[model samples]
Target: MSGIKLICGKELDRVFRDRKMIFSVFFLPVIIMVGIMSLVGNLSNNAQKDVEAHTSIVYIQNSPVGFPQFLKAADKDCKIYEMSDWEKATEMIKNGDADLLIKFPENFVDMVSGYKQGDVIPQIKTYYNPSEDYSRAAYDTISTGVLEAYRQSLLSQRVDNMEGLTVFTVNSDNPDMVIQDEEKAGGKILGMMLPYFVTILLFAGAMGIGTDMVAGEKERGTMASLLVSPIKRSSIVLGKVIALMIISGVSSVIYVGALVAFMPQMIGGADLGMNLTLNPKQIAMLAVLLVAIAFLYSAIIVLVSVFARTTKEASSYVMPVYMLILVLGMTTMFTTKTPGEWVYAVPIYNTSLALQGILTQEVTTMQYGITLGMTLVFGAVLIGVIGKAFESEKVMSI
Candidate 1:
């Protein structure tokens, strides 16, 4: 234990002293995150502002009733430009010159009236470019308003003619109304991203440290001298793995902290509308999960690196492992439903999913314990493999 701790301390000191390590482990990740956040923020803001500022909508009509009133109401939000040419109106939407384009069939008024009189009416067709996001939103709002107004007009006429009929209204209250907001939805998205980023940094940091410890030492001819010493081969592997784990673990902590520190300002002030704040308890849970991920990834990378003769070869060998971890971490990002129990049993998947659950404050004690236990188990297996590799003549020859 003392030997492992000594090696851990020495490796950590070496990492801190190296400018390249400082830049890669801490500076580069933060810069990449901030750049991505800024670009996404700008795009969202521009989309919303463009929708609000542009008011020119082209509508093609053939003497439709109530269409004038709909246009009048929508005019309060934006200027309505009614066009006779459907091709031109469509071109306007396609070229981004118009916010929306509404097209009415030649017999739309007749069809609507016939349907009101209990006759079959042909379906009314409304055309808008689906490729334009704002056009889609504008058309959705307009269609909803028109339908509601038409329904009310029919209801009023029925009520005027039926004096003997009575209408009863029943109201149901919703208890979960507080959770119905864009801010909550954005927070949920962030929950998915946070854990995945932590896992990525864990894997990256582990690979970086493992390459430096094994292949770098071999390249520098320091491994031979270390082996010649009376130190046990198991002790050496344990020392290297412990060092790599600490480096990876510290990198994970810093990566997670950077996100947590910036999340409130980024999500709240940005257009994402996530008004979430992480407390100390959530931060602590994230730290624990990150530590487990770091240890597990470090053990695997060290074992793999031991088989490589050079840093380039070590990196090449470890690339597939990193890719697999990335794919597993990203599983939660693309999924809407909570992950299953089997997902929690997978190594990297468990850490990523559990971290997401922790961020959202949805994690149970059972899930947390299971993920941690699985990580430790995998770490033990990886350490065992590294121990065997250390005993091999091929590794020494390398």
Candidate 2:
């Protein structure tokens, strides 16, 4: 035990002494997270701005008496266009030269003027490309506006004659208990996003130190000298594993802290409206899950590092594991439906889902046992492999 502590302290001291290692393992992640999130937020805001700034162009054919005036009154910014025929209008819309096409019968106003309350209503046809943003926008604005304006016109014609229409709207749900729109929006965003970032950071922190500890040492011959010393092979492996776990776990915590502190500012800039809140117990459980998962990731990375003869080879091997973690972590963010309960026992994904639940106010106490227990079990198996590798000259080759 003393040997393990001594060797562990030596490894930790060596790592802490290097300023570059400290910055790369801890600070770099925070910087990248902030930069990427800010870029995403900016791009998103730009797209929405473009959508709102857009103006629709309309093509009129056999124009109704008051439809054009109604459209102009509804949105004065609309650009009115005239086409030779339906064929020209279709071609114009198809070529993106126009956004929407409206056609009306020459006598359409006379029909509306003579109609009874229950008579067959005149029909108007409108066309717009569903794929074109301008076309869709024009259709939505002009169609709804023209309909309302025409209704008001008909209503005015009968204003003094009758009072047959009566309309009332009813509500059923309790306003106090139902979730707000912003809260639902915040829920989906937080539930999916938190898991993706945390899991990737966990894997990244472990990969950086784990590869350097065992594989870098093996390549440089330090591991061989250490193995040949008075210390037991188990003690050496245990010391190294402990150092890796602590370093990677601490680095992961730093990453999480930086994310929680600065991400909202970078991503949303102020009062993000995310409405994300976690109680004390939930946060404590989240820390427990994160620590256990981080240890598990470190053990797996160390196991891979032990098998490789050099840091480069270890990195090559670790890349796939990183990719796997990314895919699994993204399951929550990219997937339309959260994975089922049975998935929570499946190692990497379980941690991500549990983290999502914790942040989104949906986690249960049973999740702590399931996620922590399975992750520990997975980590133990990897630790056993590392110990066995310490006993093998071929695998731990200098």
Candidate 3:
């Protein structure tokens, strides 16, 4: 026990005392999170602003005498193009030269007046590309203006002629929506992101310390000094794993903290902390899972680095592993539904799914148990593999 503590203290002091370590572990992740969020927020705001500022040009086919004025009054910035060739105007709208096209049937005004006088109402076609945001905006605005005019005309005639009288009035009561489990805007965003966020931070933390402890020591000819010490190899491995876990855990926590603080502000109308819910068991299980993830990643990194000749070689080997982790972490981002019961047993896949479920407040205790149990088993297996590597004298040769 004392030997393990001795190695743990030495490694911890070596890492925490270094200025480079402090900057990399602490400040760098914060900088990355802030920079990425700023860029996304700026780009989204700019795109929406551009869509809103664009003016729609309307191409009218066979418009009545006073119809153009009504169109202009509804959208003051609109420019009306009267095209006698209906096909040409439609082609213009399709080709993106015009934002909207309005076509009126023959005798548009007479038919409308006739309809108001108890004749069948004719259909007016409003055309715009639904895929284009600007076109959709134009369609909605123009349609609203036309529909409002039609409705007012109908009601005005009813009151003036006293022909139709309404006994019941429509009373709009904006009722509350009831849901089984409600997720806030912020919780949704955080749930999707937390898996990836923690994965990246854990990898970052592992990459530095794992390579330095194994490959760096090999490169510096310092592994011999540690190998000669009269201590159990398992204890040495344990101490290193524990120290790596601490460093990596700290890095990830820093990232999660920054994300939680900024997420609500970054995502409009989001209340992450205020509206979030997690059962005590779920929280405890999640914490356990995180610690287990740290251990698993650290053990794998150290095992790989232990075989490398130098820090550069260790980095080369870990790059693909990091990439794999990234690809796996992103699997839950778009999924609207949680994974099935059986999937929670898969290692990294389970972590992402558990996080998704937890954030959305949808996970069951059994699912958390499955994830936590599987994680412990995986970490234990890795510890055994790494312990054997430590015992083998040839492993230090690289």
Candidate 4:
């Protein structure tokens, strides 16, 4: 026990005492996360504002006498032009020279006024480039605002009473008709994304320093010093794994903290309906789950580091496992429904599932139990394997 403690203390001190390691592990992530998110948010908000303030250029063929008045009324900045040929106008829209092209049938107003029961209705055709932001915005505004209002006016003239056309209204004035589950609704957007980020960051935290700890030492010919010490092989392995787990766990917390703190502010004027709030019990469960995940990640990294001949070799071997972890975390990002209970028996994947459930306040005790138990079991087994590897003198001497 004393030997294990000594090894653990030495490893921890080595990391903490290094200024470069402290800055890279603890502070660099915070700076990059906040800087990137803030820059993206500013750019997005600027683009939206530019779109809103842009003046739309529209071409209309065979428009009714007063249709231009309606277009100008809806959007004062809309520049309307009369076009005899539509092919030229369509090409202009596609080429970004114009925002929209609308073709109204010849004598459209007369046809609507003279329409009878069971007669074919007049069709209005519109063209715009969906890839162009200005064209798409102009189409949406004209379709919903100007065109809808014109249709309603024509219908009112045809009917004796407009109220006769209405059958029923669906919660028109009362928005409280929704049975709001505040618990699940609060963190809806954040919940979907949080698990994926947490899972990836936790593993990344371990991967950063893990390879160099063992494999790097071997390459530098310093691992011999540890092997010759008056310490059991298992004790050395345990101490190193524990120290790595603690460092990675703290690193993961810093990452998660930065995300939670800056994410809302980073969105600026936009609202994603995110309102994450956790109860004490949920917070406790999350902490324990994160610790277990960190421990598992530490064990795997150490095992890989132990077997590799150099830091580069360890990194190459770790890449496949890193990709697997990335895929597992991404599964929860788009998954709307939870899987069967037995799925919790899986190791890294279960951590993502459990995290999603915990955020949404939907995780069951059994699910948590299965995931936690399986993770700890895998971590222990990996640690044991690493200990056995350490005992093989031929493996270490190389």
lDDT values of the candidates? Answer: 0.74, 0.79, 0.78, 0.88
TM-score winner: 4
Candidate 1 structure, TM-score to reference = 0.84
lDDT tens per residue, model 3, 16-84:
899987897887878877777767776777777777788888887777777788667767788888867
Q: How would the candidate models be sorted by lDDT, starting from the highest?
A: 4, 2, 3, 1
* Model 4 lDDT per residue over 57-125, tens place: 999999988889988988999999998777888889989999999889988988999998897799888
User: Per-residue lDDT of 1-398 in model 1, one digit per residue for the tens?
Assistant: 76666666777888889898789887787778867876776677767777667564646556366666766675566556667777777788787677665556677655655556666644445567777776776677666676467555645654675435536433446556565645446558787787678768778867877887988888888888877777788888888888787777777777767876776444435555566766788768777777777788888888888888888989999999888888888888887787667677887788877877876677788888889999989999989988888788777778
Which number leads on lDDT?
4
Worst 10 residues of 1 by lDDT: 162-171
lDDT of 2 at 275: 71
Error of 4 at 268 (Å): 3.1
After the best TM-score superposition of candidate 2, give how far the Cα of residue 83 lies from its true spot, in angstroms.
2.9
Per-residue lDDT for 340 in model 4?
A: 95
Candidate 2: tens digits of C-alpha lDDT, residues 1-398: 99999989998998899999888878888898888887887777666667567777888777766667777887778788765678877988898878888776667778777877797787777888888777877787778876667777777785764334536434646567656666445655777777888888888887877898888988888877888899998888778888877887787788877876676666745445677556688778877887788778888888888878889999999999899989999987766575566777899888888887776666566775788889989988888888988897777664
Clashing pairs in 3: none
Clashes of each: 0, 0, 0, 0
